[model samples]
Target: MQTLVQTFMERRGDLLTALWQHLGISMASLVIAMMLAIPLAIWAARRPKWAEGLLQLTSVLQTIPSLALLGLLIPLVGIGTVPAVIALVIYALLPIFQNTYLGISEIDASIEEAADAFGMSRMRKLFKVELPIAMPQIISGIRTALVLIIGTATLAALIGAGGLGTFIMLGIDRNNTPLLLIGAISSALLAILLSALVRWFQTAKPKRALTVFGVILVLLAGGGAYSAYANRVETVTIAGKLGSEPEILINMYKDLIEANDSHVKVTLKPNFGKTTFLFSALQHDQIDIYPEFTGSVLETLVKGTNPKGMTAKQTYALAKQRLAKQEQMTLLKPMKYNNTYALAVTKQFKQQHHLKTIGDLTRIEGVLKPGMTLEFIDRNDGMKGLKKAYHLNTTAKSMEPALRYQAINDGRVNLVDAYSTDSELRQYNLALLTDNQHFFPTYQGAPLMKADFAKRHPQIVRALNRLAGQISETDMQEMNYDVNVKKQSAATVAHRYLVQHGLLKGAK
Candidate 1:
């Protein structure tokens, strides 16, 4: 508990930034939802026949899984804050809409008669009587929507929208319990505070209520204007996949770029789901640069490309050519390490089966059950191609990268697909099964950047390229171990590496 507190205190600045981001996204989403839902609810409340269908439609939207909904929106709206805010607004609609409809519809018919008797106009009656009486229910609906948005906003990080979810996802990837707890607890506290604030607003005097809302409006307008201005500035945005390696690499890029160049700023949108997500983000100019592997680019992104028998250099060259031609993206210098996908088994399991190669899995056949990440399970160059090459038949299940090691160790699964640079392979006493069939290609790590950005920022590119041949396989494995097994932060390990390599001066 003390460690957790210390961790929170150490990262308080980041937490506060995430908190502000969370508030902005959530509040903006709730405000939009209320605007749309209130009008729709009023329309529905007047039409008895339409109310049921309208309510059911929103209820159905609420039923879609939050992550699934975010994924679905990516292709349509692309990644980042827009899709996140849109998804949150969609999720928040049902509660607010239903409450508003109920509040207005349940009003006494005699009140309408009283308003008519007083020669009140329809709009005047709605504003003067119906809305005023419905204020409490409307406020209650807003409170519910606020809490819902706050909780769901954590998921916005998956799509590269900054929020407290960034810490939670980072903690999970690195297996740091303190970081995870901080993100979870802080988010809960924010929700609680916001809920209390809304309730207070419900009961507060008119002057106080107006003042609070006035302040919120001012803040919102200011935030929106600042965001607009920031977007126009010449900033290099680096994105990364969801793991310690990408996080480390992106941070290294940020540090190097900022150190070398005073005119431009570098920012990170870390943990942006998968390779496809990052690729899409780059192609759409949602991100300026991100670390990618040659093998993944060849096998997954560029469809129907056969990379068999290609050397690492050939693969890198091919990836560079193809990405430049197709996506207007350029691959920078490759790192020394090949963080390729490989199968691994517990030492005891390996000993029991005498499995030395991926082909040896054929001997175990029916006895082998493999667990891997979803991308590995579905990729053409992953299990599917490996199985065809080795002529092996085995049951495989899709699991998260973070859980695969534990599942293998616990005997829930016998074999697991792992990254060659993962630290857990050593800590868990696992043995890598060699790819004797040569099904999987070498994954040389490199930064994929927008061609225009590269052309404009040559010095920044030069600064990043200085790291090209520096990080060996052992260096990456040790860094991963430090983060995953030793529970060190990725930023700390990255900083140490930068300083040790003399890549940065006075890195603390």
Candidate 2:
């Protein structure tokens, strides 16, 4: 409990920023949905056949899983607030549109006859009679949408759209209970508060209610303007995959770029998403650069890339060549470390089973239920290749990276597939079994950028390239440990490393 409060206090600034972002996204989505759905519902109510199909369509859309919808949107819109808001609008549409249609449709025929007898025009009748009677139902739909939008807005973080979900995702990745609770609790509270505000709006005098809503709209507009102005500088945005290592590496990149280029401001979009998400952002020019692994460059980015017979240098050559030729992206000089895939087990489990190599796992394959990542379980260089190469038979069980560690620690699983340089290996004192067959590709880390960006900013390229052979395996692992286990900030750890190595001028 003390740790939870301390974590909340320490990260209060970030929490508030996330809260503002969440509010902005949720409210914008709700307002947009209201504007679109309410008008459409009114028009459709006059045409029952069209109304039935359109309302049904929204129901179908609401059925699409939030994560799946975000994934689909990434390829089209790229990742950010735009796609997040669009998704929320889709989900919000169902409730608002359906309720409004039903509300206006359910009004008594006598009410319409009275309006007609009084010589009310179509517009006046709707404003004075039909809509006023339906106002309560409309308010209910809006309230429901506001709450739904608030909950679903959390997913925006998956695509680099910042919100409270950032804290939740980071907490899960780092296995921090406090961070998880903070995001979860904050979101619940926000939803309750907003729901109550909607109820108040329903009861308040029209003038007063409109005044408060106007203030909110003005504040939102101001925030948007401020964001645009802040981004007007010469900014070089660097994004990374989800992990402490990627976060630390990007911090290193930001420090190097800012140290060398004064006119260029560095912006680090750490833990933006997984490899595919970042790569899509790079291709769409949404981000300026991101650090990528050589193995990943060939594995998923390009087609027909075989690194089977290639050494680390040979593999990098293939990846760098293909990336430049096919995608017009520059793969910079890689770091010296090899963060390739490997399987691990607790020291006691390893000793008891006498495990030494990939083939050795076959001894306990039947009883083994190893917790692995979904990516590793599906990849050719991961589980598929491991099984074919080593002839190891075991049930395939996929899990999140962080949860894998927790499972092993809790004795739920005895083995796990892991990156060779993962900090958790040292943290948990796990033993990495040897890959005698050497099936995994070399995974040297390097900075990747669009060719156009490189051409436009040669100084940034040169600055990032200076890290080519600077960071060794030990240097990276220690840095990871610092951020993951020691609770040190990635920026601080990166700066210390840079200063100590004379990459930047600073007191160590």
Residue 397, candidate 2: Cα error in Å is 2.5
Clashing pairs in 2: none
Question: How well is each residue in 311-430 modelled by candidate 2, as lDDT tens digits?
Answer: 889988999999999999999999899999999999999889888997898878777878999989888889988899999878667898999998998999988999988889999999
Where does model 2 exceed 4 Å of error? none
Top lDDT hit: 2
Query: What is the C-alpha lDDT profile of model 1 across 1-508, one tens digit per residue?
Result: 9989888888899898888888889988988999999999988889988999999999999999998998898888888889999999999999899989999999999998999899999899999998888888988898899999999999998888889998898777766789888889989999999999888988899899999988998997898788789878778889999988898888888888888987778888778778877887887789889999999988878755574789989999899898888878789999999998999999899899888999888888888878898889888789888888889777688888877887898889989999899998888899999998788898999988888888987998898898888898899999988877776777788889999989898957
- Maximum-TM-score candidate: 2
| Candidate 1: residue pairs that collide | none
My TM-score estimates for the predictions, one after another, are 0.95, 0.97
